[model samples]
Target: MKNPKLITKPFAQNGQKNAIPENYSSSMESNQATWDQGFGPITMIPVAAGGLPPKGQDFNGIFNQISESVVYLSMGGRFKFSADYAAAINGYPKGAILQSDDEKKEYQSIIDNNKVNFNTATQAQINAAWKLFSTDDMLQQLAGKQPAGNYLKLGDYGIGGEFPPEVIDANNVKLGGIYAPAGAAGINFYDPYAPMFVMNRNGMYIRQFQITATGKIAARDIKGEWKVYSDDEELKTRFLGINSTAVSAKQLSTKSTIAGQEFYGKGETITITPQGIGAQPVGNYLKLGDYGIGSAFPPIVADADTLGVCGFFAAAGAGSKNYFDSYTPVLVMNRDNNYRCSLQINVNGRVATRHRSGAWITYPTLDEFNAKKSLGEGQRWQDVKGSRSSGVSYTNTTGRTIALSVSTAGAIASSSIQIFVDNVLCSRNEVGGGEGTNFTRHCIGYAVIPTGSTYKVEASSIGLWAELR
Candidate 1:
């Protein structure tokens, strides 16, 4: 812009060249007059209240939010994923939008072809996918597995995959991180099938005790197996030998057990071995009852169908309440089918076998009582040989005809069992699915018995017999 011509003083025409007179221009002296142009005072221009295109109102940015392949929206609220992402995630082809009825049919076909059975997903799988997503490819342990949706890589965040520990740390997960095998990796005794937890306690990472496949207690860089040896005569720990769990210096392969005459057709002896390493062998196989093989050694004993030493007195049952027929007894009944025996409550309040030949023999001494207690309750005891008195019974001593009021404990489903005492059927169909524990209390009424006769169980199961009050 060109400046307007400056106002001049008329005295300058005399050529006197006098100093410029003071107060020559009052308009220039004012501060506003210095910027005053020849044009009238500048007035403010009025503008309509138009603001910049709002950042939230960027139409181009909104359009770019979704991929280009996304078809137009219909009146319905459902938004279609772009064909590109859909194909990558769901194996759909390009332009497979449900615009027309034909397109809808194609969409249904895609859904039918790609649907998955959510019921098949396990809890571990479901938990892995809750908040899962792409960027976590490294953490998707199940990514390369056989995909149910026919995709090479299932979206990690989509389902059944975990975020890496790094991702978890970066995300500040509350009290969470990868639970990796911490002890020593390969040397840490890791069991993939088992639950493992690790913690850095005092700068030392620690975890559960890991047992080796060969049944050895091992640690990283630690030579040889360090077993838990007992110093006092108290603790008794059993160790699995190089080949067998129990080590027996002596083994007897006799056919028939002395007292019960349990059939050992396989010619394998029914040895009653000691449990734990020492704990004093509760020898006196006869003490186990009128049905066990005599063995010189403790621990490590097996017969044809018999495996453990505890099975000497009874037969082991299956998951279905020790399924067994009345015809077979697991143990034996002496040659004459009678044995000298008596029941007495021991210090532990247990009805233990006391006098069974020679001096009063006591089996499963105090320390080994744990293994013996399995017989006290809901254990499924069966009779393989199927003897007459297969359960625990007491002899009738007196000549007087006595009513043998025996109470039976241990719960039973009562579904297919015929419980009988002597030659008489005591009760039939008195058991059910919910009636199997001692807590359920299924008692048998008092029945008359011959005097001086031995009382014994007639069923193959863990049961209690007591003089009814």
Candidate 2:
């Protein structure tokens, strides 16, 4: 081979290895033998002592950059996208993942060079270009499963026939007011063969109209032409009839009428004819024309219209006062019918009369009354005594007659005592004492002192007196 040489290394390789060797001989043939000694010793090339060669340094920087990209890719890192970032590139590459500027969503490019603008693109364009991986995408998937059409509207005409009264959207459920949806017009129930509705519990049946085979027809009221039967035989039923038209009296089984008049249903015509005054009594009770007798209707006689009678007295004006009779005790009352007083006889044969204020006083016996009258009006006596110096004095506030007696004691002659009533001298007396001998003397006597009067006794010399006031 002409100019053949051994090439060992390529340019700008990596790592810290020394430079590779290259040998070339001018015009060297393929089969020519080269001297073994002529061959140069295998020597290492000179290398930079402390660092890589210039080419290696350049290559190492490139490798470091490449390693960072690989680490990011292996860790599933996505591209950070912003408004400014999109303007720099036509599209993200396939397999590239990126987040929107707001960071609310992440998208992966579905095709090579997906060029759709996530923010500005239409929903269809974005979906074609990207596969969203956020919560919003999950919600979209769920939304696809909902009913196809929009929610129903209310108040539209022609409902319940071909067109339905649509169920209003939940947002507008209260649009028609408090009882909305149900309050919507033209709502119909498809009840053809069964009862319109039924209300019942598992064991207890409530109330419902029409018929039901499963639940019993238990209700508080039954109207119209309802009838009760046992074993297909009609039972006797008593009911109050209320009708707009009169029922014939001939159709009724009982002919007896109350108050001489026929009773009819509400809103019916009635004719009342006064019966002739009958002598025969109605049952055991007396009728209008029958004579009243016996205890139930005792005869009231007006001739014995006095107390202590053994029967009732019929007085013309005292009809409401009371039935005055011998057996009945009288309860005296005022004109207003309030209890005024009462007279009663005790077991001791004493007559005790009660006053309106509830005080009861008995009438005195004849002997007691006579004795009190003989005694006449009485006087109350209160003793009034004093020494010779003070004498005695009294003022009468008792509002009754009072009596006073005067006495005097002295040791000298001409010793005297005097009594006065209302400042007027009523009595005077003088006593004699001989040779220093003490003696006592009496006044004229007692004097009556009227009300609002003052009684006084004055003594001359040493004296003593007594008074009854």
Candidate 3:
């Protein structure tokens, strides 16, 4: 047995070899040389049982070694690869690490081994840990502080609500802010610069109101209690001034007088006189005792105002002689044309006079003969008989021309009548009539009278009458 300790078995393939074996060292060295020629040099480094690779080694190996050390330290001591643990190692005052399902075994091992203290932790510690592990940008966010100019501070209160304010002078009196009292309503903060208080008990605060200056309700400089109501309502008695009442047309009286003249009365009468006598009646005939001195009346004397027969005679006979004297000579006649005139009558109602001669004179009617006979006796006589007679008579002739109308009362052999004017046949009518029959005729003639001519008419029938034109 030559140096069995020096001759080692083949290195296991599980990477547990710390150093090359003596038997294979030569061959391994030659292979390494060939590999170096073909690829690169392979440096052989010694490792303790639990030590990592040294610095300046291959990065892959160095990383693996550092990872092992980290895992081992996390398992074997209070220090770990956790964020809080790393933060603590890097001089952060507080740090923490979060647990994961994959790293639970290692984390639990570290806890069980009393390598890490997880029980003595808080949100602050976790936050510190996040700050330590995160980048500078993330760390800044983890600080939980806002940048400048990012927020506002609570200011003062305003009229409707809260608002900002400022202190201007030393007294520290707030300026440019308004605070309204509870339930106090108005045009609040009426002037912000000059604050005022308006306490309206009825909650009515008009900024401005107008009052007529000429109103009877006097406004004084003194202030006192007042009651305000809607203008549409009747004013209360207490608010009404002296001598005030509701006005209406019915309240006034029409019987009132003005300027000493009576305005209203029943049945007024007025009397006027130039002489100023109240008892003097109009249309009175003034006598000597009726008027006073210096009173005047009309100068003319009317016939109705004459006093005596002389006054009547003066009014009637002022312009001519007496009427009786002018008629005295007519009572006496000197000459008479007929003293004992002989009268003769004709068949046609005419009278004639003869003067002892065999000459015959004819008067148109008896009224002419009677007038001549009265003149012979020197007597004034008036022929007054005014009618016609069947017998001839020496009297006044009353005459009328009667128009004849022929109409038959019954049937006859001949129903005819003939009309004549001045004894000459003028018209004829042969009527054939029974009931309701009628005819008409017209004629003109003359009659004699004492002083004036009279007209005469003759008719054959009694129903005939005459119309004078």
Candidate 4:
């Protein structure tokens, strides 16, 4: 065998052979030269022995190079091409051990896997939340006279946007920014129709509106829910009351009687009264003053101590003279505040009333008017006949009424009923045809009485018995 190996020129280069033997040694040497030329020269010499690779140092060198510099990292700041990817390419102690079990991986391995979770979050939500950090505005605020620190955080004081008119639309119609328009008057410009709040230069509400002075309820509707704005002035608005649609009121229940109650779906409510004495009597009781259109009652200021008539309460000047003294009983109406008709009292026992002329016709209370009097023996003190020359008078009483009925025993020429109060002129009611049997009907019922006031009822001619009601 001398050399059948010698005969074969295994280390041949082209057609020539080197002085080296034609053996494995020669063959390997030739291959090594080809490998060095094709690739780069070996960078890491094997520093250890291991079963991991054909040559430990050779494998580590290649892997270390890929991790540090050789790998083509995109470097676009995108997920796949980021700096983190570059850190993960190496093997062993210098590279990432990517596995579901974190205990087997290093710091870079944990970071690399976390990238998937990062992409799962909503980008827009992240951008929006991050914008609220107000980094720039905070920095400027802290650097009022000096530069801000690198680590310290600053805030925008709740106001947002750039110093200039920031363009946020494609056509540039929406206009807004954080800029001072004129001499020290800073403004927050924005689209007028945008669902944003109007604020002052200090980033506070422009003006506060409240149902209560403390603004406890903030905003509410007559028939809907209320919105509270206690601590959140920056919250967007819904144009409360401005853009809201109207809804009709629905009646929930009704009982139209004295002391009866009525309820509406919109929370409106009312209750009838005995004589308008309790609970917002409104029309049930009499009011001393009123100023609505076609209002009848004028304010007569009575003494608070003794209820004595002090003076007439009227408006100032010109047409305000007769307005102080009420021409008729007044009812302060509030629903819609419309003038329905002439203010009149159609009570059961209406003893006194204002005749067409400015004269008061007084009468008696129901109790007093219903009592039968023998030749004015038991007649009421408030009784007043239309034909009476001097009307009846009573110093003090709770209430009184008046009743009048006339009949002729025989054919008479004429008969009339006249009445007056406090010497005020009143018209007389006369009967012309007093034939065989004549009869006329006149009755009075419940009438009210002021505690400390005097009452008077008079009659000129009473053919029949005038009795209490």
Candidate 5:
């Protein structure tokens, strides 16, 4: 009889009426074909209608195949299928593991008595019957094995989609970016913004925080003992200004006392140095108030170098005449600071003195003064000749005051002498000669002729005419 569940074909007995030698002989062969075709890797041999029981070789063949699969499982190797497969009688139990056709990944049976060929099944069917156990790619990655290009694929770590290639080694991990690695121990993290951070065995470096980058560092306070080395030209020049030839100014602390005087504000600063005789901000300029040299008191009018005054002091030295001279006004003032007088010398060598209450008075040189005095004495007496009928006119060309005089001789009682200055009659004298005997008459006009004025003297008799300037 056939087995109820796992059926086996008929096998020959010792004595059977229908058991011929050839049929008995071929029964085992027929059953072997059926068993081999049904179970152990398919043989494709068909079973006859009344075939003998399954052969012993077929049973052994199936047992050997199961043993080989068990050996693969015990050795940490997955049972790999060459093609889609399913069992006719027995099914893979739950937890049965096998490899895919390509052997890139392994799968396990998820349901009891699963008969689905997971490699060839639809995704839904495979999900119901099998589960992915592990992947060869992930195993290679975890073992520190890189791909053909020595670059690690992110997809191997379950990351999907395309990305820039990267490398991960035993010493360092380098994510792809614009900046290249500088050393074997260097590591980098990168993104689209090109922000990269580097770390090695020596120290950590953040690209954004470097001083060369254009950004500000924000903090409440910063304290450090590190020294910075820079090669910037501007910074070097500015720092060189603090050398030996320069003044090192010290900033004053707020509300601090300096030179026995309390000062305010932190912005206040001071620079101190040796008090040389001609140093600046101290001894370079003269101080105000009373000052004297050689003696405490000197005459108001004295020769040079004998007295000193409280005023601007310039050292004596031989220089050009124009060098020591000021083209502008030089004023002398009283204690009220009002200009009492001034002394100035003109370019023509004329010295002028001025008083606060008066205008400027100029004094010529000695030669010019002598020449003018001689000219004035010569102009004191000037002679004039004229006819008795007409008047003699004299224009006062000399820049001095003058008077006119007229004398007549041989004049009758009707003869007269008259003086007119600037067309105005000033004096008239009637000359009287006794009958025919002539007598002289003098007409002295007391009229003053100003500079640039004309004076005329007329007489009826011929006589002398003169002007007193």
Candidate 6:
């Protein structure tokens, strides 16, 4: 048989029995032992107190001393372990032992009640163990199920609980133009789509902003330049006015010499009359009347061959100055000889005459006789003659009714004068003789005959008389 030994003792201190007996022999082996039987070799585990020491101490005491040291080590170096040793035992790392029977039973109850598998235990199974052995709060910490103070909710990541700050700034701010807030300093940012910043105060809300590109800046300036007009020489010299400078002149003729007459060209002339000169020419100084010659002039006479002729007088009355007659030497003649001569008379005014010679005689008609009777009472019985050789004669048959007188001087005769009453010959006589006798008789009568009547005179030896009605 093997010798039995007492590995541990039982003693009393602080009113609790020691786990080992006082008189226990080292060689005793009994069914009731203070220490575990068939336990593994005694090993020294050096432990430090409170905080970990620089070097740990080993225990080589009696079994009880060793057991107490083990208890102290398992108690985490505390003088008094908690009455809730099950909770204490749970605090140990996995696979550590329970110190008391109650702690073992409590730990066994936790293990039995919990469905824990060391290889397959999850945080949920460990939480079940903690609930059986420890507090609800301690179980929560053990299972890593604690609340996080700064945990982000769904989709909450960056500042503003949204996208990045820099990205938001870039999207919202105007890129290029100067930013001049109501009363702040102007910010220098240049972009094409921004407005020019006009600095204003006093809360005048000009809320507009503008931007322009470099190319657009030049274009706008050029557009403004197009609207600009300048009187300056530098600008005017570049842009000149278009107008015409050439002019044309035309010639015209006028009837006026007055100063304000519109003159189109040089050297225009006008004519003037005597009235224009305000005077007339006098004293044979070429009147328009002096140019009257030929049929337009009055008659005149000159003396010829000693014939007693008066200067040409207007034909014996207040008649035209163009009339005249001539008289010559008187002569007596026998009743039956030839006589022939030429007689001359001048016509005046618009009057004229012609003569008949060979064998023609003239007699007065009743109207002539009556017209002659209406003339002043005169001596009757005048005998006129025609040229006898020319075979004609004339006489007055107005008996005792005094006949008109005749101028026998310068009359043609031998040249018998015969007077006829009605158709009958009443008297005959002769005047001038020998061959060159020409005679003309003047029969005087009233200038007018009765209204319904007419007068005529016929001369046998010479001149014609135009009767007036």
Question: Which candidate leads in lDDT?
Answer: 5
Report the C-alpha lDDT of model 5 over 114-225, residue by residue, as the tens digit: 7766554447778998898888788666766544555435553223424422333212432222232233443322122222232223233212111223332221111212
Cα deviation of 220 in candidate 5 (Å)?
79
Best of the two (1, 4) by lDDT:
1
| TM-score, prediction 3 | 0.14
**Per-residue lDDT over 1-469 for candidate 3, one digit per residue giving the tens place of the 0 to 100 score:** 5522331222232343233222333444332322123212233333444333422323333344445555544454333334334443453232233333222322222121122222223334433333323233554665657664633235423334444232222122222233332222322222223332222223333221112223212111112222223342233222323234332222123453322223444434322222322344778563552322123431222221221111111212233232222111111111243332333233354545444323445544554544445322433222111212112222212222122232223343335444444444555555444455464432222222333233233333323322221
Instruction: Name the Cα RMSD for model 2.
Output: 52.9
- Judging by lDDT, tell me the better candidate of 3 and 4: 4
Between candidates 4 and 5, the one scoring higher on TM-score is 5
The candidate maximizing TM-score is: 5
Q: Which stretches of model 6 miss by more than 4 angstroms?
A: 1-120, 131-182, 188-469
Candidate 2 vs candidate 3, TM-score winner: 2
The number of residue pairs in model 6 that clash at the backbone is: 34
How well does each candidate superpose onto the true structure, as a TM-score? Answer: 0.14, 0.22, 0.14, 0.14, 0.24, 0.13
Where model 2 places Cα greater than 4 Å from the true spot, the runs are: 1-380, 386-393, 410-413, 436-444, 461-469
Give lDDT per model, in order: 0.32, 0.44, 0.31, 0.31, 0.47, 0.31
Model 2 clash tally? 2
Comparing 1 and 2 on TM-score, the stronger one? 2
Residue pairs with colliding backbones in model 2 are 1-30, 309-326
lDDT of 2 at 70: 57
- Count backbone overlaps in model 4: 34
Q: For each predicted model, how many residue pairs clash, with residues at least 3 apart or on different chains? A: 38, 2, 7, 34, 3, 34
lDDT of 1 by residue, 1-469 (tens): 9744433322223332322222324553221211123111221222243222222222233333332223222222333323343344564333333321112211222232222211122334423322222233434556556555633244222123363222211112122223323223323233332222222243343323334444434232122232332333222222322122332232235444332223344444344443334445666545533334453322322222232223233223232122122112233223332353333333454333422322333455563453334322332222212112334454543233344433344554442234444545665434554633554536454454544455454443434333311
